[model samples]
Target: MNIRGKLIIIGGAVDKGSFTETDLDKNVSNNLNFFEAGILRRVLVEAKHQEKSRIEVITTASKIPREIGPEYIKALNYLGATNVDVLHIERREQATDPEVLERLKAADVVMFTGGDQLRLTSILGGSLFHDILLDKYQNEDFIYAGTSAGAAAASNNMIYQGSSHEALLKGEVKITSGLGLIDGVIIDTHFVQRGRIGRLFQSVVGNPRTLGIGLGEDTGLLITNNSRMEAIGSGLVILVDGRQIKDTNLTEIELGQPISVNNFAVHVLSKFDTYDLKTHKMHIQSSQYI
Candidate 1:
């Protein structure tokens, strides 16, 4: 698949506090603050249309849309974004609203906030708004960004319900169709913080052909042209590649029984590390400034 736009998949807990404060600072230099130098800041710069960027923030995934909406607007505004509008489409009926579509049409960057992944797909699936969003993602010079639940819903296959501790058991992980912005991949957020590696592993094993991407909080994966991904942020990004698996007991086990597999490859990457999805290989480099 050839994707023309860029994807900024964040791992949730992006700085929404004081831009000048150092509370959220992880690996950032003293000269660079967290809010102005965090993952979201990198996303804004990568959009490359910041000066004239008309950002449309979709808060449908958030349970507290009103609260999350303004927070993003404030953060973006602090980052020098002049025109950031919050599209509070909470219902399926609101997704096809003319005013909503109009704003989406003119947006240079479309951001989805964190909440429930199911809410986003259920509300916008098969709607005119979704079709337009997918079209823009494939053909326009657009930037598609999502954090947490938003990030999990960006792939063709999404893990809706699952517990990491019970992930090794058959049928423990539940998956459904996502927005299909990117193909052959499944994404999970707040990975390390939430101890979600087992669930991500289950996802990759079930759909062995699909790559699994686990993102840590405050970290992000910048996917360009649907092929290469570059890690950005203070946390780590874990990749589970099951293409080389030699054996598995998935078929023989019952729905609740544990599964066994061998030869599954795992890769851990940090900031500035790059991975080629097509080749299933990674290139790691040490941080230059650190």
Candidate 2:
């Protein structure tokens, strides 16, 4: 029961944009080569390693028909996954079942689809399902990956408060409990498109205790086996540092006020770029971000 593996969160925008052969090659160049060469095969190459055969899709927040559709399921099967279990977690009866936990324990990649993140929190909050989610992260047989709201909830601190246009002013945001698979930071998804710079600031200003991370659509951050994180996908992963802020004039902020936020620096990166969470330093690594 070796439970150590990297966690990769792909923000909403999966299967979107110009992810053609050329684009995928350009974007995931090294990873594509690995896939072609069966390099990723070793990650779960053996029958013993192949026991990770389940997928728990939390459709609690978004309608399954709308979020992922049918083609996505077929894609998983095409990838040679023997079992693909769809859990309609929104239904109260299913939500309360203990069997749900067992299914989660058997999953290889536990994917969360995009929807209202607030809805995700409201439904799974304080439930057995939430506990099982945390347990899976601790388990040796699972991998956690979320997109959109799913990506947002992976952080220790959840920024469920404030809108994209609001001021970064003080007390404008709220932090709620997430699954807590990863700690010491907050995640905000749909970063660039939603223009959520202010919201991240509001989150930090409200909490002032954790780091803030805003990931753009179609982009992902993979925390590798070496304990270093690399940005992947089409867009940039935004890192906001608030460790140096002395004070924020959020109290003086109005509804919008252009959402001015100080004491926060933003870092954007493409694939092959790495950022160390332990040392709080950003660097480019020799290794490719596959």
Candidate 3:
């Protein structure tokens, strides 16, 4: 099915004016705040209007929703947004609240913040709110944005648990169903900084038909039609294609065993680079994002 909405999947730590959290690797010396490299401004630009369009920041996955919600508001306000609001769906019952669904329906852009992906799926998945959101995104002029856990959970399949150190081992990476915003693709955040390439590889190797995307810190992809992906932000976006695999013992391997695979294709993209999910090819945009 073709989708009309936009998907902005970010790698997190994109200087929301109050962003100071370290990535999965605990790197404290990130030099991203000094310039205009953050993707929040692009989020505002992606919306229909800066002043009038309502942008809803959903913080269901965040443990500190009260804190993260306001940070997004501050960041969007800085980008000239005047009609921004925060929604914290703390429980399953809250997902079915009439007022909450109405608020979401009125929003032009709904962004999911970084946190626990499981919380988002368990709480909002299969609910009336999810139905409305999916319907609106596929039919209306809406935008769906997410960072970190939000980005990971936006896909139909999610990697809920996996350590970078043991990702290459069979069965080390655990997968689960997500919000079902997009399919035939898997997303992994903090790819460069956290060394999560292995898990993404395992994800694609397990299912060669699936494409894996690894987003670096402060980087993302602006996806449209659920097929065309334009790279955004300062860091890198890696694509893992396992469609050409010739030989592999992944199915025969036991738990914790190192699975081997051949002919895994990889692509590294920067800002402005566009990828076609249908063709499995990337188009380069000469203009530098930095």
Candidate 4:
């Protein structure tokens, strides 16, 4: 299926804001500042209507929707986004609300804030809202963007549970079905800051056919035409390729035991780097400072 839409999978920022000015700046040295930096602004610019686009920020994954939702609105509003609103769909019933469906239908970009990826998959999966989102992403020039846990749930396969420390142990990294927007890929956020490389490694080694994407803080990928991804923001994007793995003990290793995988290919991508999803290729351009 040829997709006509785009995906912006962000590495997340300081989204657990308690409604303070420090909410977005608490981890500025390690987090993506959507307004001052490029991720959120890029989301607006990618929209067909720019700041006028009807953007819906989904807070289904956030426990404190009251805090996270308005903060996003405040940030986008600062960027001159006129029609942005927060959709605090905490209950499953809200997934089928006519008003929610209407707003979704009229939206140019849907942004998913960080929280619990499992909460998002459990509540919205198979709902009419999810149906429309999938259809729009496949048929229209729509945008589906997510950050942190939202980024993890953007793919068909999601990693909901896994400790960064024990991720390499067999049976440690848990996997589940996601929103199914993109196939054959798994996305992990706060890669560098959280040291989640082991989690991603265990994930891809278990399912070598799937591509593992580790997004660093203050970084993201602007995936256009559904296949070409341009690394955006100010950090690194790690591409873990398990397609060439020569051997792995994941299939035979006992629970809590270490697993081994050989021939795994990894790529470290920085800003201005491009990767072809369809061909599994990475293209790095000359450094701007060089």
TM-score of each: 0.92, 0.77, 0.92, 0.92
Tens-digit lDDT track of model 4 for 118-187: 9999999999999999999999989999999888998999999999999999999899999988888899
Candidate 4, after superposition: displacement of residue 25 in Å? 11
Model 2 Cα lDDT, one tens digit per residue, 1-290: 23364566765666432233454444433433323223122223322345355655556657663445343454444446566656667755565687886776566666677787778877777678777776656655466667888878876678777766553544556678876777777888888888887777777765566777778876777764324677876677888777777776666666545444456766777766888877878886554663
Clashing pairs in 2: 3-140, 12-148, 169-250, 170-250
- Give candidate 3's TM-score: 0.92
Model 1 lDDT per residue over 45-147, tens place: 8775874688988998999998778878867776678888898998999889998898998998999999999999999988989999999999988999999
Candidate 4 — what's its lDDT? Answer: 0.88
Runs with alpha carbons beyond 4 Å of true place in candidate 1:
18-32, 287-290
Model 3 has an lDDT value of: 0.88
* Candidate 2 Cα outliers beyond 4 Å, as residue runs: 1-5, 16-52, 65-69, 169-174, 224-227, 251-261, 286-290
Residue pairs in candidate 3 whose N, alpha carbon or C atoms collide under 3 angstroms: none
Q: Which ten residues in a row have the lowest lDDT in candidate 4?
A: 25-34
RMSD of each: 3.6, 5.9, 4.4, 3.3
- State the displacement of the C-alpha of residue 164, model 3, in Å, after optimal TM-score superposition: 0.5
**Alpha-carbon lDDT, every model:** 0.87, 0.65, 0.88, 0.88
What TM-score should be assigned to candidate 4?
Answer: 0.92
